[model samples]
Target: MVCAVIINAENKRIKLCNEIIGLMYGYIQWNSYDTEAGGIILGRENLGNDNLIFEFITKPMKKDIRTKNRFLRKDSEHIEFYKQLYSKHNGVYAYYGEWHTHPEDIPHYSIIDLTNWRKISKEDPKEMQYHIIVGRKQLRIWEMRKKCFMPKLVCEVKWDEINI
Candidate 1:
């Protein structure tokens, strides 16, 4: 586990003790929800940047467009709610990535997942990134810097505890 403070790369593997790391890790731990669909968002302030903690994340509770419609539109309610969150946070925060549940056991991706990731990969490719796939036993994350999405093998992650 790399123990340091780097916000741009959201995929920091650390012992589950720190609150920020633990929160992200903990949020990914729950696979009990019938997340017919969901998404992950990531945000963080540059480390050592005063008290202004530039950290945030957003996930839209989605419809069952059949096992996580990653390309689906965001409902207005989610949009508005996020707007409020952003207003309160005062802009240091960013919408980094998303989390969702699938009907698999080992937390893998589907063809659709690859498609969605491709779009994200096209955007910046170096900024902070986020992703979550809740399978039967674990949740996986896809946080590779500047790598285009690979539908067949999108990300390497596992149950809150990342597979770095």
Candidate 2:
């Protein structure tokens, strides 16, 4: 299968891994959809291609709801916070995409997932955007280009454990 590695410049991979694992374990142990978490991915593309260098997992809004297999939430607060952080970092960090978790071992995007992704990407058309769906055993990557969503052939580097 073709892939494009979602390169992490520093400790980003580790940090994201830790977060995903923690979320998974928490959900499995607690038996609740409330444990499901998601956040924004921020980074730059200095090495020719884009890479997700940083991540910020945001808390769901008070009015949001979630399910065992889905994270039905909103990102307004997350977007506001990310905007502030991006400016503080002098544009070095911007919204690249999003990340959310699933309860299965092999993750797959639902139709709703794809639709939401398209909406997010369309809101900002200056550049390409990416999204990640973290499953228990694997994480799937997708990219939005020209208003279309496609599975990204993420070239896995050193993140064999996460199956990048």
Q: Which portions of model 1 miss their true places by more than 4 Å?
A: 1-35, 49-73, 124-126, 147-164
lDDT score, candidate 2: 0.57
- Candidate 2 local lDDT, 1-164, one digit each (tens): 22233444333332233543344333331334445556667654445443345445555556555666667667477778778887887777667777777665666778888788778767885556667666555666666765555545342222345432
Model 2 spans > 4 angstroms off:
1-35, 47-52, 59-61, 153-164
Residue 63 lDDT (model 1):
39
TM-scores, all candidates, are 0.58, 0.67
Error of 2 at 132 (Å): 0.8
Q: Which ten residues in a row have the lowest lDDT in candidate 1?
A: 2-11
Write down the worst ten-residue block by lDDT for model 2: 8-17
The superposed Cα distance between candidate 2 and the true structure at residue 72, in angstroms, equals: 3.0
RMSD of 2: 6.3
Candidate 1 residue-wise lDDT, 1-164, digit = tens: 51223222224431122333334443342345443545445354446542223244334444324333233535565456567777886854555555565555677666766666667767854543456565555545565444634432334434434432
